[model samples]
Target: MEIRRTPVLLSWICLLLAVFLIPGHCFYLPGVAPADFQKKDPLQVKVNKLTSTKTQLPYSYYSLPFCRPDTIVDSAENLGEVLRGDRIENSPYVFEMREPKMCQIVCKLTPNEKDAKDLKEKIEDEYHVNMILDNLPLVVPIKRLDQDSPTFYQHGYQIGVKSPHSEGKDEKYYIHNHLSFLVRYHKDEQMDVARIVGFEVKPFSVKHEADGKWNGDKTRLSTCDPHARQTVMSNDNPLEVEANKDIIFTYDVDFVESDVKWASRWDTYLLMADDQIHWFSIVNSLMIVLFLSGMVAMIMLRTLYRDISKYNQLETQEEAQEETGWKLVHGDVFRPPTNSDLLCVYVGTGVQFFGMLLVTMMFAVLGFLSPSNRGGLMTAMLLLWVFMGLFAGYSSARLYKMFKGAEWKQIALKTAFLFPAVVFVIFFVLNALIWGEKSSGAVPFTTMFALVFLWFGISVPLVFVGSYLGFKKPAVEDPVKTNKIPRQIPEQAWYMNPIFSMLIGGILPFGAVFIELFFILTSIWLNQFYYIFGFLFLVFIILIVTCAEITIVLCYFQLCSEDYLWWWRSYLTSGSSALYLFLYATFYFFTKLEITKLVSGALYFGYMLIAAYSFFVLTGTIGFYACFWFTRLIYSSVKID
Candidate 1:
């Protein structure tokens, strides 16, 4: 039976291995629709935003052409250009944006002038209450005499807006805003790219304007919230349009071209990080690592060694029976934990998450997932997580049966669905709220169905296959025999209590990664770029070492206290970092974010729960196995009759 089970499991593993390794027909990254590198010279601009610059939060922009494409609706790949963050709606302003014109149309007297009031109302309703440039993307224009032109990083843009009264009541007319590009150069005036230092912004809204044409008129407006307080005041001119003529708004996006080689674009971004904070965090984590390493060493070399030596020297059975400490607990050390089936299910899910994290990080570090690749990282993670279900099922079923459990089917079912269902439910609820807000970030119904199909079709069947094979195999061999009657656990001191120890044990692991956590949080919420996967991989290794070493040290202390309930303690001790992470996130929000909307706040914390839960499972899995191996090593070495 054991031999047969091995072949079945191997077959499944081989099949999956082939699937992942194979490229063309196996899997393709979905929903990545980044603009092509050099589609055309000066890509005809996309769209204008509907939201005002005065609004606090960022708003969506739409594609005027895609909404009303006339044989020029060029889109790449599977996604329609309109569906991919391109607010496609009918708008009168589309033409003004597409074909902006600067004209001083004098309202020539018509045979019988059309109702001036109706024309004014029509213009106000059609044109979106005047227009303002809130955000824009700029391309790098440089002439490098080296190899073929290197890819230039796009500059971030923010055109500021403001008014006269900080509170209310103000008198002003049509105001003017000017934009200037600030350029920086090396001491020698050499550069590969001329990075924009900043931009000069002036914002105002039209308080009033003439209805017809430029026939000597005046208007009202307000001024800035200034950057580089050098404003070019303009004489108020009667810039107007008639009802029957074509009205156009014209502006130029002139580039401040430079002739210097730029520093490596990647290095420029990396320098933005404060080095001191990273060093401080690294030193702090190292100190904890050294402390835990010393403690584990002392226990293994002195305490455990001395106990094992003393037990071996005892000649008579009575003398051996008198031995204590960890040697005495060997009989019940491998005893099945209370609710072993549930514990096994939990462990299995933890294994799955850990496995997915491991594979995803490796791929990221290997350069398979770069910033240019867009959705590659997330797509890879999702696929790997689904494929890891087989391992989850095998681990859960194998452990459950080892605990002398008979319900293999029950354990397998929970292992497959429990954690995933919880995450999906929370995600669906949050998505519904996003839909209510009519945000583009909302997952379409088709995408949701695709996710469900992936889960039911691939993950579930793989888990079932694994469960069958695991049940066919014999239970995992226990190093020490269990007694029919359970051993009575001794009362532990305050310091030795599971909760206290678990709390203390968690501090080190959390400290190891808190510095990196800050940068990650900033990137997500502040919308900054974060591409430090190489550094993150090193931190990941440090965290793994910290978790295992601390758990082992704590498990040793618990056994010495004559407490046999190491099962939950081991899991929670490392998993407790999730608690610290949650607390830190709360602190980050209060201190860092200015999020005012209740719905946004709810969405923030709701997604955070999912992240924290996954972290708990991943770290918990590492600690459990570390303790499991430690317990098995000590007990199996003792001379048990």
Candidate 2:
């Protein structure tokens, strides 16, 4: 009986272990036979990258293949779907690869004589070879993604155009496109395969020209464009062949097994772009740091020392220090600012933005958020911002109440809804436009409603809770007493004018990060992968330091001029960096981008405004806090009567 009971216990233990292991292993061992594995498809074809040979730039393959919206079979795309950054289209026009001989004709570029003549007539009688609007050019325009890039990430095109060069007197020869092949050996897989790498502009033979056969020696099979070599074109510029050429495009495909994974295919290109831009950014940021540090050091060591000594000597010497500088306006410096409530709200929003930025950057550096992860960065940012709403409300409510106010409810409401509501309204409008265009980048209606629910249900309630805690306490105690009557501000010098000083301070911080701005814009509009979050995090820290130091130095100068209007001036001085950022973006748009559509231009500027406003809030808050500490330290140290 004892032996039977012991065996039963051991059997129960074995059963429990099997239960745990089966669930983790998909429980397929019982249902899936070994024969079933042989029936599954061995491989799948995915949409690869689009690239141009002339510019060596990657583009979205979908951008070039113009398919009619009415012909689309499916709809209801979401922001998360776009963020996933996969080839969203299921059509073969976007991506399809198989045996080269199995390629099918997708498009035919037959020249309509009437259409060509109409386009020629529309050309402004510019005397020379014909030039058109390029809207229906023989070549295609494309945009690509950060992730979901193709193998090798090169380019290939087989557009047949009429070659001016004749094979022999009357024998006209048309320019033909050939796909370059690469022979690859797979070590681990023990197989060999050939792949189509790119398009050959000129394919020639090495077994003697008269043989008309393939050759290993690289040579051009077609005539070079003499006029093209003479003229200069921008990088990734559109191709313009002699008008009225009927270009028939064809495809050649092949694949080779390799140890290299898909993720590392574009590593070389991204590394090169990052390395060059990172060095330039570091050098520019160092120069700005040196200038800002020099100014701050002067104020701390020379200016502040002399003023403090003079005041101290006069105090003990039974002499009165002249009331001509910053001390003269001490009575009004801490007097609650006009629109204190609004300023509180701005500061709160700034704090929230600042916190969200730091958290996002931190997550990015940790590799938790990445382009490959598809909406990981954005989803993280939105979640963080929602949770961080508590801080925004608390900061605003605490500051507002500290100003001897009783309107905690008003402060909380604005803190929770003001900027977020405005952003959502604009976002929905833009999304509506995308939906109208039937773009895959549009967010689904259900996702938008879900976002609204998160905002109102979770974020708003958290804000209210934080405000309640903040208002429960008494107004913050002042280190120095305020005079019953406000002191008169002395006339300021031209150099001390708020706007002039702001322009100077703003330029310095902007200069520190402007080089970085170029790379960021390239990553966004150009769809290049940005994996250098470590460098970005460093730049962010430098920007904060530059803003704080510059604003503190400027605030000191304003006080020296007996100006007590430093409340708004202090915030705007550092916050002015955003204005320069916007101006620089406009400059970049006109000079760097080839965007021609009116809607694209509008979208570019519209999104830039949102970025600038967020920057203003972030930098402005930094400046305000630094000045606040500086004022408290100086006033508390002095013997004010």
Against the true structure, whose TM-score is highest?
1
lDDT of each: 0.58, 0.58
Poorly placed runs, candidate 2 (over 4 Å): 1-41, 47-80, 83-252, 257-266
Q: Which stretches of candidate 1 lie over 4 Å from their true place?
A: 1-40, 44-59, 63-160, 168-251, 255-270, 315-318
**Model 1 over residues 1-641: C-alpha lDDT tens digits?**
22223444543443354223311111111212222111112223333323221111222433111122233332221222222222322222221111222111112221113433333322222212112111122222333576574533323332212223433334211211122222222222332322322122122211123344434212111221123122222323322323333222212222333332222223433345654566566667778888888998898999889888878787345676576677777778788888777778789989888888888775554445544343456677788888999989988888888888888888889888988999999988887876776655566787677788879989988777777788789988988898888889888799997789999988889999999899888766654446656456657777888999999999998887778888888999999999999999999888987666666777778878898888898888889999999998988887778
TM-score of 1: 0.72
Error of 2 at 383 (Å): 2.0
Clash pairs, model 2 backbone: 59-143, 59-144, 60-143, 60-144
How many Å off is the CA of 235 in candidate 1? 13
